[model samples]
Target chain A: MKTSYHKLKNFINTPFGVILLVAAVVFGVEVLVMEFLFVFVPVIQASVPPIAFNFLDAVILTLAVSPALYFLIYQRIHADAEKLRKITESAQDAIIVMDNHGRVSFWNEAAETIFGYTKTEAIGKELHKLIAPEKSLNAFNHNFKGFQETGEGPILESVREVMALRKGGEEFPAELAVSALPINGTWHSVGIVRDITARKKRENLLRERERELTEVNEYLRNKEAKEQALLASLGEGMISTEIGGEIITINRVAEEMLGWKEAELVGKKLIEAIPAISETGNIIPPENRVCLNVTAGACVGPLTDDTSAFVKKNGESVPVAITTTPVIIGGKCSGAVIIFRDITNEKELEKTRRDLLSLASHQLRTPLSGTKWLIETLQREIHGTLTEKQGEYLTQIYKINERMTNLVHDMLGVLRMEGDINPAKIEPVSIQTLFGVITETLGNVAKEKNITLEISKTAESSIDTDSLLLRNILECLISNAINYSNEGGAVLVETKRDGADIVFSVKDSGIGIPADEQRQIFQRFYRATNAKTFDTKGTGLGLYIAATLAKKIGAKLTFESAEDAGTTFFLRLPASAK
Target chain B: MNHVLIVEDEDFLVRALKDNLVSEGHSVAVAMDGEAVFDELKKKKPNLILLDLLLPKKNGFDVLKEIRQSPEWQLIPVVILSNLGEDSEIKKALELGANDYFVKSQHPIQEVIEKVREYLEGKGSTKVGL
Candidate 1:
C-alpha cells in the first residue's frame, strides 16, 4: 500500500498529473458549493429563477478555484525554468543563446572559457562578429539572414565543424550544434560548441603513419620483383634451400636441368628431390650430400664436388659440377645456395683433347726419333768412317735433333699437366737418392756449361711422394740451375728437414731472374728477360711443368731470386703427401 | 752369334736397326708387319725381338699377346720400342708381357743395341727408358 502511494506521489509531480489533479480539485469545490447552496440557502434558491440560480452557482465556483489553480501551475513552471538554467550552466560544451537580432543573449561558463571572453562581455554582442573567424563572417552573416526569418537554416538544428576565433585572435576547429527557440514572438538560437583540436591532431598522426606504411610496402614489393629478375637471368642452374635442406626456391635453369618443375621440388628435401650419384654408380646418401652439409652448418666454406652425377626426373644421369655455399645471416647459417652446371660437354671435350695430345705425341716423336737415330748412326760411323769435319757436322745435327726431341717432350709434359692425367703413384723416395739421380741426369748439361754441381745431402729421411713427379721436379730445377749459370759457377743441390717437411733447395750462382719478371717465372712460355738473353734454347715450360707437378703431389714450390746474385728454388714436401 | 728379329714397319728405321745388328755380329732377321713375325719365328728362333708398336697389319699389342700365347715364342724376350710416351700406353705394353719398354726418342740406338745384347746373353728382364 505504501509503495502504491509513493508511485502516485511521483506521478503527481509530472506536468500532466498536476493538471489532472487541479481539474479534480476544481470540480470538487464546485460540487460542494452547489450542494451547500441547495441545502442551507433554500430561501435564496427558491426566490431566484432556476436559470439565474445556476449562473450564480457557476460564478462562485470560478471565484474559489481560479486563485488556487493559477498559484499551483505558475509555481511549477517557475521551478522547471530554474532547473533548466542550472543544467545549461554546468554543461561541458559551450551553451550559447542568440536573439533574433543576431546578438548574444546568453552565454554559459563554457563559452567564456572557450572563446576567452567573460559571459558579461559575450552577451548582447553580435555572436558571429565576436566568435566566428573574420574570414567566416560573410558566410555566417549570409546564413543568419535566412535563419532569423524562418528560424531555420542549413546550419541550425544540425552539428557542423567550423573554424572558431578566440578572444586573443587565435583560431581552432570546433563542433557546433544549434537549435531554434522562440520566446515572446522572437526567434532565438541555442548552440552547443565543442573544441576539437586534440581530436584533429590524433587524426593527422594516424594518416601520416598510414602513408609511411604504404610507401614501405611498395618499396618491398619492387625489391622482390628485382631479385626475381636477377635470379632468372643467371646462366647456371641455381637452387636455394632452408637450413634443414628443404628446397625454398629453384630457378628456371635448375628446373630444366633436373627435369623437375619448381612447384614439384619446392618444400621437398634436397636429397630426395634430386639424388646425387657417385662415379661408381652408387647413390650418395644424405650425410654425404654437399647441399645438406652446407645447410646443416657442417661444412665451413663453399664446396665443389664434380665427380658426382645427378639423376634427372627421367632417370638419366648427368655429370655436373656443383658448388654449394652457405647463406650466413647475423653470424648464423640460415640457408644454402647450390649452383651447378652440366659438365657432359666439358667431359667429352676433355677426352677429345687427351686423345689429340696422345696422337700428337706419338706422331711428333716418331720423326724426331728417326732423325736422332740417323744422326747418331752417322756420328758413330757404324756404316763407314767420317772425316773430322763430317763428324763435327753430324754432331751439330745430333745436337739439333736432341733439342727438338726435348722441346716435344716439354710440350707434351705441359699438355699432360693441364689435362690432369695419370694420378700420382706414391712411394717412399729417399732425398739423397732422388738428388743423386737428378744430378746425374743433369751432369752432362752442367759439364757443357763448365758449372760445378755440388750436392749437400743433410736430410737422409725418405719422404712419401710420387717418385716420378719428384724426380721430374728435381731434374728441372737442377737443369735450370746449370743452364742459367755462367761458366765455372757453382750449383748446390741442398736438402734438409724443416719440422716434418723436407726442403730441397737448388741454389745457383747464375744470372738470377729479374725482379719484375720473377712474379711470372712459373708462367707457361714465360722466360725472364735476362735468362732469355743468356740461353736461347730454354723451352720455358720446365718450371711451369714443375710447379703444376708440385701441386699435383701436394708440395709447395717457391723461389728467392735477386738480379745477378743468385736464385734458390725451394721445394717443400709435406711429411704425409696428399 | 745369336739371331735377333726386328719387327718394324718404317723402312729407314728398319734398315738402320738391321745394319747395326749385323755389325754387332748378331744374325739379323726382319718382319716388316705384325703378321710376318710368326713366319720369321717359325723359320728360326731368334734370341731377341725388337718390337715397334705401330705396324701395317696388326699392332704391337696383339703381336705381343699372340707371342706370349705360343709356347715356342713365350720364352723369347720382346722389348717395346714405341714413340707413344704416355704412361698409360707404356703400362699397357708392359702389362701385355713386354720384357722391356723404351720411348725411342728418349733413348739412343746404342742403348737399344746394348739391351738386345744383354737379352741375348740370357740376362733377366729389366725395365728401362720409362
Candidate 2:
C-alpha cells in the first residue's frame, strides 16, 4: 500500500550484502590457513614436547567463527531498512517529486490518493500534464526555462488558490506548495498540495453583497437631489418661516412680491420684514396668524380665507391673497410655508365697480324723492275732490315709486358693503337702541301688510357694533320675514349673549326657506326657489350684502328653517368684534 | 336779493344752478377755478360758497384749504359739492370744517337750491353787499 524509496535505496546501496561478503572471506581464510599449518607440521609439535591433540578441537573452532559474524551485522541492516520505508509512505499531505525533465520520479501513496491516481500510474508521467492538461506543457516549458537560466522558479507554496484537474476531468480549487532539491545528483521538485474550494466560494459571495450596497447608496443620493430641486422651483410666492416667525427661504416670487432681496430678509421676522394689516386696518403680527388648509398635520396644502394688506418696501400698502400650510415633521408642527399673490389691481377694479354702483343707486334717490314730493304736494292741494279712478291711478303710481325706492336702497347697501371701512365704528349701542331703529325702519312696510314687528333683548353690555350696518342687516332679515309672512303672522327680533359671542336672532312665523336651498341663500344673486313663486319682490342682493358685512365684522350668519315651521336667522358676533 | 356763489367745473350743472338761483330771487355768481373764485369774491363778497371738488385750475380741497387760511373769508360757509362720496373723502372734508358736503347724485337740482336757501337763511345774511 506504500510507495517506498527505501526499497530502491537498499537495492542501490547494497550495505548488508557487502558486510556479509567481507565476513565470509575472513572466515574462509582463517580456517584454511589453520588446517594447512596443522597437517604439514605434526612432527615438529611431537618433538617439542609430547602435546595432547583431538578431532573435536577443530570442529568447535569453525562453529564459533563463521555464522556468528554474518548473522549479527547483515540482520541489523535489514531491520532499519523496513522502518525507513514505512515513515516515507505514510504522510498526510500529497508529496510528489519531479525530475529535471518535468517527469514524476517519486509518487507516495498520499500523492496517489490526493490526485485520485495510483502511484504506478502517476510515476514517470509528466507532473504538469497530470495536474493541468491544457496549460501543463506551456507552464512547464516556461518555468523550466526560468529555472535553467536564473536557478529559480515559483516554489508552489502550500494550498495556493488555483484550479487543479481531478481524474474525472473536472477542475476544483486547490492549494499547492513545491520545493526544489538535489536527489542522486539530479534536481527535483517536491510538491505538497491541498483542496480549497469552499473557502474561495465564500469570499466571492461577500464581495457581491458589498457591491450591491454601494449601488443602493448611489441611487438614493441622486433621488434626494432631484427632490430638492423640485421644491425650489415652485411658482407662487413661496416662503418658509421658522417657528419663531423668522423667514427661512423666500422664493423668487415672494422676493418680488414683498419687495425684499433674499439677503435682506432671510433671518428677519416676518412682521419686521413685511408688516401686514387686516382689511379692517388692524395690524396682524405674523406669529399669531394661523396656517390654513393643512391636512394630516404636514402643512402641504393651500391656505384659506387669507386676505391682508402687505406693507411694501416704500411703505405703501398693497392687498394680497395669501395661503399658508404648516410644515410638520415627526408628528410635530415645525414651521409654516406661505404662498401669496399681489391682488392690488384686482381690488382697485372691484372698488371702481362698487363706486359706479353706488353712484347709480344715489341717482335713483333724487327722482324717487322728487316723485314723493310731487305726489304729496298734489294730494295736499286737491283734498276737496277727485274721481275714484284718478285716485286709484295715483295710488298705483305711489306704490310703484315706493318699490323702486326700496330697490335703490338695497343697491346702496351692496355698494356700501364693498367699501373699505373699519367696523371699529362700533360703540356701546344698547339693545334698546337696536330695537328703536329696526322697528322704526320697518314701520311703514309692516303697516301696508298689516304685520306686527317687534324686538326683545336681555343683555347687559351694550352690544358694541356699527349701529347703521347692524340696523340694515336686522331690517333686511326682519322685513324679509314680514314680507314673506302670511297675514297676521308675528315677527320678533331678539338679542342675548351666547358664551363669548352675542346672539342676535330674528324669528318670524312666515313662509320659511326650503332646507335644500338654505346653503345657497347667503350667496350673491341667490334667491330661494320657493320665494320665486310667491310673487315677492326681492333683489337677492340684500341677504348677500348682509352676510358679507356680518362676516367682515366677525359675525357668524346662521339660520334654522322648516316648511311652515317659521324661520329663525341668528347672528353670532364675537364680543371682540365689538 | 341773497347772493350765492357757485364754483363748479361742469358747465351745464353750473348754469342750471345759476338759473335756478337767479329765478328764485338770489344773485348768482359763478367761478370755474380757484383764480376765478378770488376774482369774483373781490367784486362782490357772496353770502355762501358752493364749491365743487373737481376743477380745472385747482381741486376743491385745495381751494377750501386756501380760503380757510385767509382771514377775510374766515366767516363764510363753504359747502363741498362732489361726486366722489368716498368715506375718507367725506371725513377729510368734515375735518377741514366745511359747513356741509353733498354728492351730486344724492340731490335734485331743485333740492340742492332749496338746501342752499335753507343754509343761507340759517346764517341770517341780511346785509346786501357785505
Candidate 3:
C-alpha cells in the first residue's frame, strides 16, 4: 500500500496522468448517476403513486450532485500539489526551500556536485552551516536580515575572485556568481562558483613583462642622456653641415674659432659664412662647389670636400686644414661631417720648417757663391795672370762651383717658397721685361748646351708681384727646360692670356717627364725620374719651388708630359695680384 | 760725403762696416751700445743711422723709439739692420716708424752698400736714409 502511494505520487507528477484522471472521474460519475436514477425512480413510484414522481426529488438530487462536484475539484487541487513537489525535487538546479529560519530543506545533484555534499548530509542543516566557512558564518545573519526586509537577498551575480572552502576543508580561488530565488514566500540564493587560478597567473605574468619593458626603457633613456652630454662637452671644434654646405650644428669650440656666436653660424651656408679668397684677390669657390675641368659640364657638387683656409667673423683669414666626409644615410648624401682644428700652430711649425730649410740652403749657397766667385776670378786672372794649365784647372773649378751654386740656389728657392710667408712685394711688373731679364740670365746655360731658348709673347701682360721672386721662378723653369733639352733642341717660352688669367709655359722638345713621376714632381725634394737620370747635377727642388711660387700667386702649376715626347710646364697666373 | 752712424753691439762687424764705409768715402761714427747712440747723435748729426736691433742696456727699437720721440733727432733717417728675420718683428719695426728693414742674411755687403747708395740718392732720403 505504501508502494502504491509512491507510485501514485509518481504518476501524478507526469503530464499524461493529469489527463487520464480527469477522464476516469467523468466516466465514474456518469455511471453512478445512472444507478442512483434507477433506484430513486422505483421508490418514488411506490411512495407517491401519481403526480409524476417528481419534481421535488429531482431538485434535491441536483443539490447532492453539486456537492460531489466540489469534492472532485478538491481532489484535482491535491494532485497538482503533488506534481509540483516531484518536479521541485527532480530539478537540475538546486531548489532549496527554507522556512523563516535559515535551514536547508532540499538539495539537488548540481548542489551536491558544486558543494561536495550529499543531500542526506546537507538537508535539514542550516545553509550557512553547510556552505559558509567559520569566519563567514556570522555574515549570513546580516545577509539574512537584509533579505527579510527587502524581500530580495544580497545575491552576488558578478564573477568575483574569492576563496571558497570545499567539503574537505581545502580552500581554492574561485569565481562566484550568486542570485536569489523566491519560492513559497521564502528567499534562497544560488551561487555558481568556478576556479580561476590559471587566469590570475597569466595576468600576473603580463604585468611583470610590462614592468621589465618599462625598466629597459628607463635604462635606454639614461644611456642616451649620458652619450649626448659627452658629445656636447667635447673640447674640439665640431661642425656638421648639410649636403648643400649649410651649417647644421656647431659646438662652442667652433663658435670661438669662428669668432661668432652660436646663433650666427648655425643654418648659414658655408660660403656665405666665409667668402674666402685666393692670393691673387680672386674668390675661391667652396670646395664642394669646385668642379674638375674634365667633369665640369656634368658634375654636381660633392657633399664633402676639404679646404686649407677659412675667413673669420672679423673678416680676417686664418689657416686651417679640414677633413670632411659625407654623412651618408640610405646610400644618399644626407649631409657632411667636418672635423677641423685651428692650424695656426701647425702653420707656424710649417713656416719654421721652411725657414730652417731656407736657412740651410742659404748657408750652403753662401759657400758655393764664394767658391764660384773665387774660381771665376782665378779663371779670368783677376788675382794674377794664370798659366795655361792653371787656367784649365780654374775652369774646372768654375764649372763645379757653378753646378753647386745652381743646386744650392734651387734648394734655397724651394725652402723659401715652402715657408708660410708670402715673399712677393706685389709691385707692378711688366711681363716682357721680366721675361727678358730671366732669359738673359739663363741664355748662357742654353748656349753651352747648344739648345735654342726662344721667348714668344702671345699677349702683353703686367702683374703685381715680387720681381726678384718672379725672376727666380722664371729662371728655374727656363733652366729646367734648357737643361733637359738635347743638343740643338728648341725650348720655347710662351705667354698667353686665358680669360682673366695670364698663362706662361716652358715647352721643351727633349727628355720629357714620365707619367708616373709627373704627379709627385712638385713635392719638396722630389725630382722627375727622367730628370734625375738625364741631369744628375740638378737639385730636385726646382719644380717644388715653382709649384709653391705658383700657389703663392694664386696660380695653378700644371704640366703635360710623356716619356720621350717632351713636356710643357704651364703656370696660370691671375690677372690681378696681391 | 754722407755722414753715417753705425750702432752695433758686434765690435768686429761694426769695425769692418765702418772701415768699408770710410773707404767708400763716408764720414762714419760708431756706437757699440744703445745708451751711447743717443749721446753720439747729439754731438754730430748723421745723414743715416744704421741701427742694430739687439743692443746692450737698451734695445735698438727702444733707441729708435727714443729718437723718434725727440724733436732734434726725429728728422734723421734710421735703417733697421738685423739678423732677426722674423716677419712680425720686421712688420712691428716698420709700423713703429723704422725707415727700412733688411735681413743681413739675404743681402751681401755689396748689395747693402748699393741699396744704401740708391736710397741716399733718391727722393726717399728725406723720409728714410737721409
Best prediction by DockQ:
1
Query: Per-residue lDDT for A1-578 in model 2, tens only?
Result: 12246334434445554554654565566666666666655666755443344445545654565466656655776677567556657876667778877788877777776678888888889878887657556766878866643336874443455577877777877777777754443456777766666667777777787788778878887787775566556666777888666788887777777788878988887667788888887777655444423422344655654468888787777788778778777977777777777887877777787667646654565556556545543443333455778767777776677667666766676766766443446666666766765675577667668888776657545776776667667877888888788888788877877787788888988888898888898888688887767634677887898798787766788899997778999988866542
Query: What is candidate 1's CAPRI-style docking category based on DockQ?
Result: medium
Residue pairs in steric clash, candidate 3?
A156-A178, B47-B130
True contacts kept of 2: 0.04
Cα TM-score per model: 0.77, 0.52, 0.45
Better of 1 and 2 by DockQ: 1
True contacts kept of each: 0.66, 0.04, 0.00
Higher-lDDT candidate of 2 and 3: 2
Residues A474-558 of candidate 3 have per-residue lDDT tens digits of: 7778888888888999999988888877788889988988877777888877877778778777877887787777676667888
Cα displacement (angstroms), candidate 3, residue A438, comes to 9.0
TM-scores for chain B, listed for all candidates: 0.94, 0.89, 0.89
Scored by lDDT, the top model is 1
Clashes of each: 0, 8, 2
Interface RMSD of each: 1.7, 8.6, 7.7
Superposed Cα deviation of residue A235, candidate 2 (Å)? 1.3
Pairs clashing within candidate 2 = A156-A177, A156-A178, A157-A176, A157-A177, A159-A175, A160-A175, A160-A176, A299-A326
